[model samples]
Target: MNKQAQAVVMLLFGGAIVRASLTDMYLRYVKESLRPFLIAAGLVLIAAAVMTLVHEVLRPKERAEEHDHGHDHGDGKPHREPWVAWLLILPVLGLLLVAPPALGSYAAGQSGTALSSQQISDYPPLPPGDPAKISVLDYASRAVFDKGVSLGDRTVRLTGFIASGPNGEPILARIILSCCAADGRPIKLGMSGNAPAGLANDSWVEVIGRYTDRTITDPVNEETIPYIEVETWTQIDPPKQQYE
Candidate 1:
């Protein structure tokens, strides 16, 4: 596309990045250090726009001989370029400036709201009172499907936000998904022991604890509550995105 169109697209994306960063949504979905890339890209687009403007103003008028080829479209007609060509810069600028945040309660109750219920027989058992090293997706998947069976009786640590559930008690929660937030599934964690005082919904926390299999009968279905008997609860910043 023409430089002017490209510049406009870049500006649009730059605005989006600014909005996302200011709202902390970028941190939720993207790494913090990458924000500068957006600003740089936007500046480049602005520069390109200035260059295009200068070139249009400074170019000498074409002589009549330039049209000797008998072209139906004369040079006097303004050049037109597709707008889509300029759109390419948007994603790059958006990522560099402010990546989108992880899905939160806004997507908690949609269809495909839980992880696959496959038997996790291969997962190694956790040793009591040890810090568990697992991906966020694996943790969420285990919580959703395996629940009691997956956790069994073991001490582990998990980090995520306190998401709202149907009931009033704030359930320790995390998201698991096959793709983006639109496909995210919510996994509720059972919190035990002394939870940190003044824990609010959406507050980020790390819980080091053990698991107990408790059967919870939901109105929709019978599910197991894989309870985490909290050994210690520490507040922390939430990740930018729910899924890696």
Candidate 2:
């Protein structure tokens, strides 16, 4: 592509990145801690594009003529940019219009929890609260690997979307990202003891429960999933950050 065309594309892409980072939209694709770095990268791209554009406009006519002649063939048509260069605008348009929705139950169902065989060290007891809020990943890890010993008798609140089990039974689940959505996987917890019934998949909810000894086997991966003896549950809006 010509330098002028390249600079315009760069400016659009960089502006999209900066615009996304300025709001919570970026959290849908990456971790909250990555916001600053994303903003910095966007700024760098914008600076580079601006510099290229300035340099192109200020070039002496003699130098421009000489450079063009050096590479120009005896063709009748003007040079055209590569078709692939236009594809870069797709993401820019998407970013400007609407960010993609966060991963949901379908992704959770396709994924299997590896924490069943994992050896998580004893986590400290939950802090004070009748139903102390806990992350779905943390709760699942403690229940499966640590035998729920750290959870004690305290009830904890877990928030996640509903995912169906082998028998079409409802279960609580959340996606866990190692770095970004590309490496994300779901951690699951089976619901027992007065578990909510007839809830649709991906209906975000806050489940109140304590760890239980009961376990369920995941048919897809043949991994064991731990249970929570649910005291109660209530439907709610999805959280601002969907992944753990």
Candidate 3:
């Protein structure tokens, strides 16, 4: 590609990235903490593209001279690396034409939780709240590895989607994202009783339950997953924040 074409493509890609971040479309792939970084990256890319365009426009004769020099001394063979530049179009098109959806139940079921030794330390006390709203990772750590010592008879509520499980069973599942959807892992909690009848896959539900069993084993890792004795549940609209 020529310098002008390259600069235009860069500008389009940079604008697309900025637009996605501004519109919250970036949340579909990454955590909210990355918003500022993404915006900055997009702006930097845009600035680089604008500078390249300006330099190319103002010094067209110099660019032409350099191009001639590059070929004139050589065998007049074209550079093979320019074709690789086309690969950029794939992500650009993906963002512009068909923005991908967030990883859902299918991906959750496919992945398993792996707790690093560093992450298995003593958890602090739960924050103040009725029922003490807790995260799936916290519940899993306390219930599985800590043997439920921290969760003493406290009524806790968890919010996640229904994942695929054995027939007549309800599995409460959450996706734990480190950086983005590509690095997300699934943390699952099994329910003792059946879910509300006919609850579809990816159905967002708020489960009001307490830790039931500490011996629950994860099907994926053969380690432990959180088990909750269902006190009650209610179907709700998908939350604005989808990942933990």
Candidate 4:
């Protein structure tokens, strides 16, 4: 690849980043807090490409003079980049053509729910509502550490995708992201009672349930994840934001 091709590839890559961020598609890969940084990075890439092209076009005479004077570092060869560097544009092309969906049940089933003391105390008080809406992370923390004190005797609603447990039981699960999909981890709650009709892996669903005393211990590591006594469930389309 030459300088011009490299610049063009940068421009395309930058444009794709900016577009994804602006359109909220970046949520699939990164947290909302990273929107500004992603946009800034895209703009910097675009500016660098534009400046490089401008300099080349505006200083044609200087380049010609350098060439005539054999200013090629006296190596008898002009600058050249390795051909493999052109592969950088493959990501941009894939993003443009496919626009892959966010991580799903397959990833959730592969990992155990991670718990920490600091995270257990970080959640806000349970909000006011009939079926108090709460995140999977918050639920996991309270259920494991506090023993569902805040959630006692109250119906709670959780929205997430269905993941198959090791024994093929349907579990309500969501990916918790600190920064991006690369670092995302799954937190899950086991559902009791009948699963909603047509329940399948990766299917988004809203579960109305209460925390149960039953705790599920992972067979591999013995980490305890809580269970919920489900009252009812409704299948729904995947939300615009897929991560917690």
Where model 1 places Cα greater than 4 Å from the true spot, the runs are: 1-6, 11-101, 109-112, 118-121, 125-129, 135-152, 177-179, 193-197, 215-225, 240-244
Q: Which stretches of candidate 3 lie over 4 Å from their true place?
A: 61-73, 76-84, 115-121, 166-168
Query: Which of the two candidates, 1 or 4, achieves a greater lDDT against the reference?
Result: 4
Worst-scoring 10-residue span by lDDT in model 3: 64-73
Model 3 lDDT on a 0 to 1 scale = 0.77
Supply the global lDDT for candidate 4: 0.81
* Residue 183 accuracy (lDDT) in model 2: 84
Per-candidate local distance difference test: 0.57, 0.84, 0.77, 0.81
What TM-score, computed on C-alpha atoms, does each candidate reach? 0.56, 0.90, 0.85, 0.89
Ranking by TM-score: 2, 4, 3, 1
Looking at model 3, residue 25 earns an lDDT score of 87
Give candidate 3's root-mean-square deviation (CA, Å).
3.0
TM-score of 1: 0.56
Q: What is the lDDT for 229 in model 2? A: 94
- Tens-digit lDDT string for candidate 3 (65-138): 65444444376754433567778777777787888767778886676655433466587777787688998778
Tell me, by lDDT, which candidate is best.
Answer: 2
lDDT of 2 by residue, 74-135 (tens): 57544555579788878888888876888888887888875657574778878778889889
Candidate 1 per-residue C-alpha lDDT over 1-244 given as tens digits, one digit per residue, 9 for 90 to 100: 5444554665556556566656656555444565576456656655666676566556664633232323335656544444566558768675666544576654543332353355553555654445775554455455555554666555567777775544555556677654434546666655657654577777888777665554343322334334466788888987645544
